[model samples]
Structure formats: C-alpha cells, structure tokens
Target: MQPDSSTGLNGKGQDLKIVSLISIGQHPASGRARRAEQDGRAVELGMTLAASSSTQNLTVLHAGDSQQAALRSYAGMGLESVRVLQLRESADAVKTLSEYLHKHAPDIILTGVRAESGESSGMMPYLLGESLGWPVVSRIADIVSIKEGVAEILQALPRGQRRALTVRLPFIASVDNAAPEPRQSAFGPANRAFMEQQQCHSEPDTARNGWSIVSARKRPKRLKIVKAKTAADRFKAATAKPQGAGGKIMKNQPAAEQAQAIFDLLLEEGVLR
Candidate 1:
C-alpha cells in the first residue's frame, strides 16, 4: 500500500496517513476482569500513536463482533469510531484481517506484540507483513519521524538498551511494553463512540484445531543478584549463566554403597554442605 502524499498532511502541518489500529479484547475467562482494565496493550499503543500530531486520520478495526462489550471499553479510551468485520468463532482470522486491510489499504498498521487470548501465537505482525508484503518493525518504543517514505523509530531492546532504526512507510509495527502506558478510557467519550459493522465470509481452517491446548501456569521466579559494580561487571553478569546443581548417580550399587553415594552426591551438589 502506497502513502498518498496529497492526503498525508494535517492542518497541524504534520505529514498524515491512514493509521489503522487493530485491537482485540481479552476473552472474559482470561483473568482480565479482575483488573477492571481491558487486556489490549497493543490497542493502547495504537491509540497513543493515533492521538499524535503525526497521523491525520485514524481508524480502529476489529475482526470480531462490533458490539462486544470489550470493544466499547476501547471506544471509551479515545477512539471516535471503530469498524468491525464480523468474524465467526472458528473463522480464519488472519485471512479475514488481511482481506479488510487490502480493501482499505492503510499506510501504517499497528498491533500488539501478542493477543491476550486464544493461541496468542504473537505472529500476527509477521503474518500481516507477509500477506501485505510490507516491512515490519517489532518492539517499537517510539516513532521519531516520518519523512518521504522512511520512518525513524526507537526500538526497545533487552537490558534497558534502545536502538534507533529506519524503515520504509506502509509497514507494520509491534509495540513494546517499554512504551509509555496508555491513559484510562473516559466513560463519556466511550458512550459517544460509534461502531460500524461489515459482513465478511470466512471459514475456519480446521487444521488449527489440531493444535493442543495447554493449561496456563505461573513461571518460577529466577534468583538474580546485582553482582555488577562496573561496566565490565555488568556485562559479565548479563552474559553469565547461573550454575546448575551438581550431583552424581550410582546405578545398581549395593545398599551400603548406595547410601554412601547418595550422601556424597548431596555434598557435591551443596545440598548438605
């Protein structure tokens, strides 16, 4: 999709483009209701960009039911209107999303790193990029500037590092958590927002059903020590892997010997030391 230069400028003298902010609500069962906040970090990121002076026009899009309560929650956040392409529960979401994007041909598309429900494959940006043949910028913290066809952006990296990059226009970007948090949705604006719905034919790809569902669980916390005092120390601390427990096993040993071996292994592993 090419960005039309004529339609690119806003009254504020900033270059403009049709920025599509794709949003998905977290499934009610996804443990988000307890927080009383919608589970769409990507939507917030897109909202932030849409509110900026850089974008002349912004359109919010969703593939599911337009009337979903969670969608209204997004409207309350700041969007004036949201367009929905009704999608069945089992429909091929990627295909449907691509079709709508093709028809609208937005110059810039923004999405979250991953969805809060379903497979949460975190591959939407990649898939959309592939389908639209557009360059994708991941973990974007900020868009510094967009002149002509190139955009300068700041990327968030591990260890609190930031990287600057430039990419051509008509691209997809995945927002990083490092970006500023979004403002809370106001009840008044949310009530005034309009929702536009469109019908689309999309069938489920049964092949996706073959995938296994795993129970969600909390990850064990890793023990970290601030052993670094200087730049070199910090580098070493960042690169070094924690040592694993050390032990020895005895196979087919006599009872007496096995007991002794077990005691020795405990000491070797520092369990008894």
Candidate 2:
C-alpha cells in the first residue's frame, strides 16, 4: 500500500489484522431477515482501515448459519469472501465467538453496537473485551489515524458531538450509526463470494431456555411534532391553542411582533426561563 498523509504514519502502517463481526439481522417493521445497518457500517469501517494500510487482512466473520442470504448481502459490498463458524441455532454465540477471537488474536476488532435480532442487549463487544482482556471502545464514529502502535479514534457523543481518544494496538470498537454510511451492495460480488465455513464447538444456551422470553411492551404514541424554521414561527405554533377566557388574544399585529410580545410576557412571567 502507498503512504497516506491522513493516516499520520511515516509510511504504510503495519499489516493490521482486522476482523469485523456480522450477525443475521431482522427488519423491525417487516420482521424479515436482512443485512444489519450498523454491522454493514462496521464492515465499511473495516474496509476503510484495510485499504489504507499495507496488507489485506480484513476478515468478515459470522457465528451462525452459513446458508443465510443476508451474509451474502454483506459480501456484495466488495468482499471476496465471508468466514462463517458453523454453530447450531440453540448454541450460545458469546462463548463460541470469544473462543474464535482469542484463537485468531486480530489487531483490531469491529462490531455493531447491538444486534438487530434476538436479545439485542448491546453487550457483545463488552463481553468479548472482558473475555479477551482487550480494551473496548463503544459507539465510535471513526478511526481518525493510526501511527507507530496507537490509533486516534473519534468516539460519538450525545447530541451529535465527538470525543477524541487514543488507544494502543489490539482493541475492540463498536461502530455507531453516526459513522459513515455503508456502500450499496452489488449483486455480482455478493453472488460470487462464497461462505467459508468451519465446524466449531457449540454449547446450548441452557440458561436462556429456563428464562421465559416475553414480547416487549408496545411504546405509547408519541406527541405530534411541529417543525418550525424560526423562533417566531415556533412560538406562534406552540402557543396557538384556543384562547381561554383568562388568556390574552392579540389582533391586528404582525406575526413577528406578536411573537415578540408573547415572548416578553412569558419572559416577565418566568415561563421562558
């Protein structure tokens, strides 16, 4: 690979073994099998990291059915192959995945913040990090640069902000939705890339069997949202309810001026504080 100034490295970065974990995604509305959104972004992030460096060591991995069509959908995004560890449906994924990751010992591991199917507990990365004793960075937007033996990371924060961090080599990161969107999947590569499978030891989720799974309570209807471009428009709409006998109703005034009057009234009444 050629040297890139953006990576903050003197030359090409060392061959960084990158592994992106994928899972069978379920569409929320349709309840159909599909490629997961965040996992796809994880793969996209992995591709970006691999393309910037010297070696092509990016491996897309799954720990479930090899015959699932969703896996191919991921490969359609320019992967030559996807590695699958064959395990039964009843088996627990965390233990098997931890074992596989420990054996390979990749330099960087990428995964979605949470799975789209099943429990969706959003704890896979943390569990794996704890098991492997590797540093775990959660909800990261991007990896800004890598140099010598450290990586500069941009972690996503609340309210669309970002926090910069630097961590040493060999860490796991959970890609957030705030990261770059994934490339469109193509039919050719997806159809051509094969599922490389290997039989792995599996343990039944005996604990899960004992716990009863219940459907989550439906969310209450949300309040109607009124979008306004300006503060005056917002104030007019928000305070436009039917005027009660005790309420003051102004007339023959420009909307901007009326809004200003209301604002002043509210401010003086301690309602705008």
Candidate 3:
C-alpha cells in the first residue's frame, strides 16, 4: 500500500496552523545587524505563508524583553496584535519562552537564527525545539506549502543554493536573509494595533536565582548612539567606506617576485611588522 502523503503518517488529511515567533531587536551593545534583518524576514515569510495558505490559521508572535529597542522594532513592524511574552532579564529566557509555546501548541513556530544579546546564542530554536520535543529547521528561506500536518520548507544553504525539506507539524523554523524583502509597514495598521494589545501573562518565578539591583554612583552611558534620520542614510554610511584603494595587482609575475611584491606593498602600507 502507498504510504500516507497528506498527513505524512497515515494518509489522513488534517488542517495546518502556523505561528511565527519573531524577535524584535538586539541588546544595546550587540554589534550584529542579523537580528533586525531576521525579524523583518520573519514578518515577510509569515505574511507570505499566511497568504499562500489562506484557509490555514496564522498568527504572528513577538517574544523578547521589554527593552526600548525591542519594543520599537516590533511596534514598527505593523503586525496585527503581536503577543508579547516578557521574562526577567536574569531569568532563563529559553525556559520561559518554551513554556509559553507548549501552552500555545502552534503547529509551526518561526524564530530568527539567533539573538544578538548576552548569549548571542543561535541555539534558541534548537533548544526550544528540544525542550518542547519538536523538530527545528534552521536558516529556512521559505515555506513552499502546508498540507495536512506536514510543511514543505526551503532551506537556504551557502553559495545561494536551496534545499527542499519536509517536516511534520509542530516544528520550529529559523528564518534567514534568503527570504523576501520585508514589506513597508502601513501607518494605519500600526496605529490601530495599539488599541488591541495582546500581552501574554508572565509565568511565576520558580527557579531559585538571586536578583540584585546594582545602583551606580555615577551611571556612565554604555550604549553608542548614532542619530540618523533615515535607514537609507545609515545603510549608505555603513557600506560606503572602501579599504586598500591604492593596492597593486601584479599578474604574470614569478612566485618569488609575487611574494616580494606583496611584502613591499605591506611595508609601504605599514601593514607589515
């Protein structure tokens, strides 16, 4: 007998549901732009998935601390009623997030490849999946289709190649830059979302972890503040700098001559000891 295709189990057809858990922003000190890009990708992929499977239930969730950066990033996404799950800064964030997902029981959970804070651990999805006994697909570029209880995922590999994968329901996927560009948020939807707040109830602290508020006598600003009116200006400034403009390329030279030329260039540029 042919194996079940719809359910990917017993051939029984079942409805699919998707829940995207997007992280808003990194800590004040983190230097990587991956988190912001990932958040945008999550929303873009979630919107695409929702549109493709209009019949399936879809919900977008934001899981992170209440930092100013995080809140602003998520609030500006123009998402419809994001579910905010807050946890203590010193608490086990992974455990807290996992517990929430267990209760929510979404068929598919989407998160970024990693967070840019304290741990900067790209292990959230894997750890969360392990804790919840669900499969995880990292660096997922797109969701090709969702049928019955299985989803067709497109994993982005190195060198711009893609791999097709099929995973059962109740899985986690970490989005990457290979996904489509995020849409420009509509001001009307963003303004309306404030009226419909969906805040998740904070779980009680069970783990015994000491908490101490360290008050500084003279609090020194620890964050770097760059004032830019627009994101395009910021992007242009970041990638505009060019290095090694006067370097020479010596082709058809002997190996010994090439080595000497490189050493001379390094000395001329003060890059060699």
Candidate 4:
C-alpha cells in the first residue's frame, strides 16, 4: 500500500498524530475557571489539520488537575474524550508534557500563545520545542498544506499580514486568534465525553519558591513636545490661557480651506510634519 504523500499519511494511512495542548483559563472579570480562548483555537486548528486526512488521529491533552470542570468545555467541541496528564498546580508541566511528546512522537503539536491564569508567560512552546529539539512556529494563522514530510504554514504577522513558512513534520506551533474560530462545544458531549486521566511524574517548580509578586509600578508619562520657537512662547504654551475664542475659528469657509486651516494648525502644533 502506498502512503498519501499529499496528505502526509503513513503506509497504514493512520500515521499522522495531532495533539492540542489545553490549559485551564480564568475569566478576566470574575477570575473564574473557563475554557481558554486560545487553547480552544488550538484544538480547532488540530481538528482542521486532521480533517485533511481520513485516518489521522487527533487528541486534546491537558496537563493539570483532571477534576477541573473546565476540561469538559474542550470535550464539548465534538471530541469523544480529553486526555489529562494529572499534575498538581505547582508542578512544572513542561517536563511532563515534553516527556509525553517524546514518548508518543506526534507529528504536530498545537498550543495557545499564552495561558489565562498563573504566570501565563507564553513560554511553553519554546520550552517544549527546546527540550524536544523541534522547530517552534509562533502565532500561526493556519496550516496550508502538508506534503510528504513538510507542512506549509501561514504565520500571522502584524498589520493583517501573513507569511508563508514550510516546516517539517514533528513541529510545534502556537495558534493565533487570526486562525479560524472554534466550534461551539455542545452540552451533551461535554457531559458524556470521558476524561481519560493518567498519572505523570510531577516536577516541582523550584524557581517560584519564596517568590514575591507585587503590583507593577506605573510607567512614567510621555514627554510632551513644545512647538514654540521662543522660550516665552513655550512658557505661555505650558501655562493656562484664557478660554473662549482664543484661536481663530473657521466657521464659514470652503471645505478645502477649512481642512487646510486645520492641517496648518496641526502642523504648527508639531502634530504633523
């Protein structure tokens, strides 16, 4: 039997394995547990990639407490089950997750740019990629196509731009909001979907020992530019001036002239060059 090179399937047509890493999210307003926004998108992307190959396998994996009710939200996204690597809150998930990936050797790993709770440093993909020695693509909009052993990806760029990148199989990518939206999870599946739990080696985070977290100091205000040519003008500019009809007003004039007057005033104020 020949493998599908276009879809990048193995000889058995079931070799491609995709995994979406999910984390418990906290609502900003209430600080309550909920399905993470980006993690949902990660699962969406993983499902999208799997849709290309008929026999491809997709798994939603979480490395946290399995008892959290938020895990069901991911299962609601038309998934039969969610695999949870049971770990404590203080346990560093990178080591355990990296070990799992090493053992399974999935073709692709999808994750969110940042978590909604805890430190949320947005460093999981980098750390996991470093540990696994795989290429990590950050803020990817979509995976265009997978051929042979390479997958073409559309990387999300600033200012609504996308850059095409081709990465080999067994790579990690951080899903961006620019990607397709995730489907709404149904209540039935969420309640029925089984939570497959597995005990994993928990590595305590020693770096956070005795860590002091304080509210960050506010940034200094931006310096203002004075448009006055003379020091006296600058002083007058800084000082409060008498209100009511101080500057020339263009009430009755052509639209172009009024626009030009406004433009000139803005230019004089150093607002435009």
Query: Which model scores highest in TM-score?
Result: 2
- TM-score for all models, in order of appearance: 0.71, 0.77, 0.61, 0.76
Instruction: List where candidate 3 sits over 4 angstroms from the true fold.
Output: 1-15, 26-35, 53-56, 66-72, 195-273
lDDT of 2: 0.87
For all candidates, what are the clash counts? 2, 0, 0, 0
How do the residues 68-132 of candidate 1 rate in per-residue lDDT, one tens digit apiece?
Answer: 67677777777788788898767778898887788877767877777766677779889988998
Model 2, runs deviating above 4 Å: 1-11, 214-273
Q: Where does the lowest 10-residue lDDT sum fall in candidate 3? A: 1-10
Candidate 1 total steric clashes: 2
* Per-candidate local distance difference test: 0.70, 0.87, 0.65, 0.86
Per-residue lDDT of candidate 4, residues 1-273 (tens digit): 122345543223445788999999888778899999999999998887777667648989999899999999999998888999999888989999999999888888999999988778899999999999999999999988787878899999977899999988778999999989889989999999999999998989889766775533456755657699998998987885444454887778899999998898889866688
Deviation in angstroms for 213 in model 4? 4.5
> lDDT of candidate 3 vs native?
0.65
RMSD of model 1, in Å?
Answer: 12.3
TM-score of 4: 0.76
- Candidate 4 residues lying further than 4 Å off, grouped into runs, are 1-15, 213-273
Global lDDT for candidate 1? 0.70
* lDDT measured at residue 78 in model 1 versus the true structure, 0 to 100: 77
